[model samples]
Target: MSHLHIPDGVLPVWLWVAGWVATLAAVTVAGRVAERVDVRRRVPLLAVVSALMLVAMSSEIVPIAYHINLTVVGGVLLGPALSIIASFIVEVVLALLGHGGITVLGLNTLIIAGEMVLGWALFRGLVNLAGRSRVRLIAFVATVVTLAVTTTALVGIVAIGGSGATARESGALDPATLRFDNPFSRGVFSLGLFSGGEDHGHAEREQHTVEAVEDEQGPDETGLSVGRFAAVIYTLGPIGWAIEALLTAWLLGYVAQVRPGLIWGGHWQRSGGRMPGDEGTVN
Candidate 1:
């Protein structure tokens, strides 16, 4: 829900550069933490979770301009360290596939990875507080809270990027009407093989591309202030968050029932105090 799909050149140079530096440092730390675990076993799980995140993020909910991010699910299964690595992998792939600009890959990775790490901690804490029998409920609550925090972070990043970072797309949502103005918009779901490729709303993007080429100075302020942008995001964010939370809760609950060790025991468990009934660290 918090994936920033802002195009290249939108973010200021220093901000994105800092994002890259921070992301590299995070990956390094995650790698060091992963060294204690059996990489051979964890690698496969990492691949699967990363693939799931990539798929979920590739498609957009046309109405809300939102996509489901399964970072919470990844966090629970892979734990924080592996989840960070997986997030970096997914964001890089997403950038290549045109889900977002390559320049913002590092920032996207950090935001999504933060969601994963925070969700992991929150899920563990809630389970400890409320008891493991309510795993699904714990997952739901954790996912909702994680998405809320990360979504706010997303808004903050855009704000920090200043007015130039505002997206200048045509599908402007009328805050008063609570409706989109783009006539080509279809139903809620829109899937594209490559997000930047020809699909639903391709014409609008093509027009924007031409306009961008004409405007040598880059994007002119679309009059979409940070406050209004934040309003639109907050307006639509909860719907996407709740949808994702339900999906994650069901998924984690299923995994917990079949493979309890995946949730309760892993590298994250080794780094912290173990939970009751945990069968030592595995993978």
Candidate 2:
């Protein structure tokens, strides 16, 4: 939700540049940790996880830049160190799909990295506090927290970008009353979300209508107010966030039941179930 739904050239150059610098630093640190640990077995899994994340994000849900961000799943399955690297890689690929601006890749990566990192930290702590019976509960709470934090960050970014009153007033989509013809809807459908047959005809109507409105509205405004930003995010965020949270929780619980070592390190080597030593190290 914090990925800056704004298209290219909207954000100030300095902000995006700083984003890239921060991402590069995170990547460098993650690389160093991966190398030092020599979790040789974990190397191959990186490709699999990255691909999964790419597919999940690429499949966008309509109206908002909302998708089932399997961040919790990624953070839990892949350690925080690897999750950071993987998130950066996923953001780079997203650029090719016209997901986010190339210049803002660093900022986007930072937001996603925060999600995974918080998810990982909270997942471990919740498991320790609540015990294994409530695995799903822990993941659910962790995801909610992650989404909350990310949404706040996104609001801050919009405010920092200094969006004007006009843009702020019209920028976000109204959930209670959705106007079919808007950039948000068209932008979402462009990614193959709604296609083919009579249902698509409705989509076309909205898309074309929005384009016409854009023509009538004249040049697009650059900035959006924090109110508008939060409006769109909260309106669209809860559904997807809840969906991802429930799924992440259930899936993690399932994984824990069958192969707990896949999470919290390979502690399964000693026995049948419930991770060996399940103690002394988060990873």
Candidate 3:
């Protein structure tokens, strides 16, 4: 769900190129670290996580219009660096299948990577600082981090598409226009589409495109106020994050209790820092 599937011609060439470069650098660093950590042993598990992400994000849920990618869970299990690399690979393959635009791959990867890194960091910190017993806490934090990362990415999309500045100016012109009056509101509403009935709604949607173009052409071409944009992003981002956190925490807690060894990096047949079956070998 964390993965972004934005189409092409939305972001400027420079932004796309920059995103690609950043993703490449991040992956290269991750690869080196993976090698040092003997990540080959974990490749099979990571691959499975990657496959799951792809499948999970393939179907969209109605109303929300958002697809789910459990890359946060993957990051929790595989660590941030590996998670980033795994997601990048998965996205690359999905692009081939026409899941997302080829040009937006870099931006997509960056967005997903943000989720993985933030979730992994939050999960690890909570697990260590609060200790394992507080599984719920860790889950909550993870969920928040994931959502925040996602919202930030969404804002980036708006900024790239020139909607952010437009919204701000629209708000300045008419504060009512800034607020999300409808659940389906895609930023500013154009005046031309204020007619009655379903045709009106369709026209309103069409007007959004025209307004966006006009917004980009003016002196305040960016279409967003930086401060307001950031505020809106964080405000909206937390909602999804909280939900994910609750789900993740509950799932992880259950797994931890039933299969503690799976989470603590301990052997299944072991207790008190010793493997029960390896006693004879040690002797």
Best candidate, TM-score-wise?
1
- lDDT by residue for model 3 over 1-283, one digit each (tens)? 4655557755566777887898899899988876665454557766887998888778765445555667666677667677779878988988899988788788788888888778778877777798888977777777776676577666766566645434343334332122333557553433432322222224465467456656767656444465675685465445545556666777678767876655555222324433212233443
Candidate 2 residue lDDT tens string, 1-283: 6366666666676777888999999999998987665456557676678888787777777765588778878887766788889889888888878877888888899998888888888888888888878888999999998988998887787667646434444455522224343475553432223322223225466567556655766544433456766787788888888888888888888888876657755421323322222434455
Q: In model 1, where do residues sit more than 4 Å from their true spots? A: 164-224, 268-283
Candidate 3 or 2, higher lDDT: 2
**Per-residue accuracy of model 1 over 35-67 as CA lDDT, tens digit each:** 666666667778888999888887788998888
- Candidate 2 global TM-score: 0.72
Compared with the true structure, the alpha-carbon lDDT of candidate 1 equals 0.79
lDDT of 2: 0.72
Order of models, best TM-score first = 1, 2, 3
Top candidate (lDDT)? 1
lDDT of 1 at 69: 86
**Worst lDDT 10-window in candidate 2:** 190-199
Error (Å) of candidate 3 at residue 223 is 6.0
Model 1: residue 263 alpha-carbon error in angstroms: 1.7
In order of appearance, the predictions have TM-scores of 0.74, 0.72, 0.67
**Candidate scoring better on TM-score of 1 and 2:** 1
Q: What is the lDDT of residue 159 in candidate 3?
A: 64
